[model samples]
Target: MNPLPQNMENALTGSQSSHASLRDVHSINPTQLMARIESYEGREKKGISDVRRTFCLFVTFDLLFVTLLWIIELNVNGGIENTLEKEVVQYDYYSSYFDIFLLAVFRFKVLILAYAVCRLRHWWAIALTTAVTSAFLLAKVILSKLFSQGAFGYVLPIISFILAWIETWFLDFKVLPQEAEEENRLLIVQDASERAALIPGGLSDGQFYSPPESEAV
Candidate 1:
């Protein structure tokens, strides 16, 4: 083959130099990587504001409801008397104490849920609070059935459990989309950076450039 023309040889040499420069810039600096991570976290923080507010409201309402139940339990008679098959069944001192303890535990759990809401805990933390509340509600329901208690005793806890789950679902719904969007945005940025690294003169002054419109087509 004939030797390349002088201009063509110079052009090829410049392109090689540019390619090497681009490669050097393509490896993201620690500062830039930290900035991107912080940006992603900021996006996540902004996206969850509504969810946090909603969860706070839910926890507050739940706290109020539990407080009301606790107050009512405190005022009620020491024991419950139920009639079954014309026979009266009575719950004694130990039974009343057990019921009181159960209510106290439920109230404490509600307080914990409120604290988690205030702290803006992770989804798993919220889920765990909800799970604990649900388990307590289920236990109450089982105890009510075993004691042949009225459905009135079952209503509040069941309602609270259902509402807790609904709130959790709303929180997940609000947060998951934002998380996915952030991930996708980061991926696009990373892919663009990689592509820019492969192009001659793409990284000049430590900045990557997209192809021109005409060149892209």
Candidate 2:
């Protein structure tokens, strides 16, 4: 019998071990496992990119809607009158509304950065942004009488707060868990490979049987 190449036997053994190792995959040896992880990671990140696009779209819409509400509030609070009288309308009182849109832009940017640059498995960036947004909105509601004027006051801040919280929750619950699980799988496969490398021949004495070199030809 011709001697089996060490590498070929290893691949066969890897496929066999997949059942007890990675339930969703075969090719558990280091080289193949690394290749599989690289491929899977690309697809995974592509999926995440799509999700990021969706989230960014929502955040953009929130900012625009908040801006519209602010514009409406301005007109309602004497922007039209100031224009007719040729006097500048004092917008400083409602400047917090502008901050809301700015913070929303910041929130979405940080989200992309955390994943693309930091590769973070936690929601620290989003959590911080959400905290600031929530607190600011709360203070705006409490200290200001904008609600007394119309629902625009409460609607603007409330919707912004809700959207911010939603993004934070998504990063913490959905994104982080999935990424961490995949990473853990990859690490386990790598550890198994390193351990296997340290062992002697990955075969029994009976498996070492082989024909002469000339006969194998």
Candidate 3:
């Protein structure tokens, strides 16, 4: 075949260079990969907000039930008055103290839940709160068994435990992952901007590239 014209050869060379540059631009950069992962994680978390809210409601109900139980116990057994009674004692101290302590713990857990609700972006708070609530529920179940309590008393704790467990799972697998991904995306953008700033004549318009300037005649 005849040799290509000089302009055609130059055009072919420029096209190949342009194609290579495009490939470089389109290649999977680590930062872009992380951004994509974050997007997926955020999507996953979006579907679980309702589940988290349901768990929060369950926890609220459990707190109310425990409070009512505490009041009833105190009324029936003369809370502090029956401290020395064998049937009234649950832990090492007075049953009244136990009731108070349990109430305080439940209230703290409720506060955590409220914080989580007000600041849903804070996955750590939700995770910590759910973990503590689950622990309390487990303890309640064990104590009930030790004391030979009726099935009715076991019901609330069991349900609360299951809900807490589910909440924790959502926090770990969905909420937390999404939060981490968002942080990663922010970091990547910040890094890109910073890098762009350092480049000579670079235009930091949310990207890491320098704009082309017109050649002088």
Could you say which candidate leads in TM-score?
Answer: 2
Of the candidates shown, which would achieve the greatest lDDT relative to the real structure?
A: 2
**lDDT by residue for model 3 over 60-104, one digit each (tens)?**
665666556555544455453563254335454211225333643
What C-alpha lDDT values do all the predictions have? 0.54, 0.63, 0.52
What TM-score against the true fold does each predicted structure earn?
0.43, 0.58, 0.41
Please give, for residues 20-111, the per-residue lDDT of candidate 1 as tens digits. Answer: 77566654554565567678667557644444556556656765765565455434533233222122234443223244334434644653
Per-residue lDDT of 170-207 in model 2, one digit per residue for the tens? 66776666667776787776676666556544444343
In the predicted model 3, the residue pairs found to clash are none
> Candidate 3: what lDDT?
0.52
Off by over 4 Å in 3: 1-151, 198-217
Candidate 2 yields a Cα-based lDDT of 0.63
RMSD of each: 10.1, 10.6, 10.7
Model 3 RMSD vs true structure:
10.7
Candidate 2 wrongly placed segments (more than 4 Å): 1-35, 41-61, 68-89, 94-96, 109-119, 194-217
**Worst 10-residue stretch by lDDT in candidate 3?**
92-101
Give, for candidate 1, the lowest lDDT window spanning 10 residues: 79-88
